[model samples]
Target: MEIRTGELSNPHVIKLLQTHHNDMLKHSPVESVHALDVSKLTHPNITFYSLWIDNNLAGVGALKALNTTHGEIKSMRTSSNYLRQGIAAKLLTHIVEQATLRGYKKLSLETGTAEAFLPAQNLYTQFGFKECEPFGDYEPDPYSLFMSKML
Candidate 1:
């Protein structure tokens, strides 16, 4: 698989993101769903990436710069067809590497607390992320789980 930057316009990438957003709503309340749409991912502070295998989009992820010393993981999703293929892990590893290279001292993320999110929680835990208080503009929410790692 090859990971490329800035493929938001690709139909496959857009579809994956839309699916991710929709799935988030199913797992969490609409008010608690923080998934960004294609336009929001295009913001200057966010760096989006798409992973492709044999020219088919396999997954997508993004890192959003929260401040000079911090970053947030966003929009991480693997195509349904690519589940269990390690696509999410690969994208996550790439995002963390990029954050470290950017001189970010910490990386944080917010994910759902629903059962559907267990795999994601496990993946972040494997990377040394531990549950933490909400950062940035987030407030305490029963449906949201916040995690962070000191890079």
Candidate 2:
């Protein structure tokens, strides 16, 4: 497996992100889904990456610069067929390493609080992320669960 930058135009990458966006909205209320779309993830402040295994797209993740010392993890999603295959963990591990390399003192993310999101929350917790108050432009919402870890 290999992680590569760019390739945003690749068919598999686009489909994976579309599924991620759709799932977020499907599981969470419209107002509570904070997942970014392809355009949002394309910002200059954000870096997107896709994981490939034998040239097949396995997962995708992105990191967004919040400031010089802070960053946010966004759009982490593994293809349906790759579920439980450690794809998400690998993408997350890569994002955290990139955050550290960028000199970020902190890395944070927002996920849904619904039962469907428990696995994701647990994954973040396993990586040392703790519950936190909402940051950035986010406001207080019961459906939104925010977490952060020191890089």
Candidate 3:
């Protein structure tokens, strides 16, 4: 699959992001859901990407700058049909590479701690991310888990 920068105007990408956000809400309480919508993903500090295979969207992810030397992984979602195909891993690798090239010393993320979120938690762990305390504007919340990796 080829991964490339994306814009909010793409309807398919927009729908996938909506699905992602909705899924997060179902898996976590509203107060714990941190998934960004299309509009928020367009912020200047965020770089969004779509992974396409045979011109069909396979997954999506983004990197948001937390500060000059730190960044956050956001909106990482692989289409349901693409699950277990390593698409998320590939997309994550690309994001990590971009962060390293940008001179980010670390990358972090926040995700749900519910049973529905176990797969994502495993994926992040397999990718070398380790559990950590909340970062950014987030506060301590039992329903949320934070992870970070050195870039």
Better of 1 and 3 by TM-score: 1
Which runs in model 2 stand beyond 4 Å of their true positions? none
Q: List the residue pairs that clash in candidate 1.
A: none
Q: Estimate each model's TM-score.
A: 0.99, 0.97, 0.97
Clashes of 1: 0
lDDT of 3 by residue, 1-151 (tens): 7898975788889999999999988878898899999989999999999999998889999999999999999999998889999999999999999999999999999989999889899999998999999999999999899999997
In order, the Cα lDDT scores of the candidates are 0.97, 0.92, 0.93
Write down the lDDT that model 1 would get: 0.97
* Top candidate, metric lDDT: 1
Name the 10 consecutive residues with the lowest summed lDDT in model 3: 1-10
Name the TM-score of candidate 3. Answer: 0.97
Candidate 1 lands at a TM-score of 0.99
Question: Can you give the lDDT of residue 25 in candidate 3?
Answer: 83
* Ranked candidates (lDDT, high to low): 1, 3, 2
Residue range 25-137, candidate 1, lDDT tens digits: 89898999999999999999999999999999999999999999999999999999999999999999999999999999999999999999999999999999999999999
lDDT of 3: 0.93
Winner by lDDT between candidate 3 and candidate 2: 3
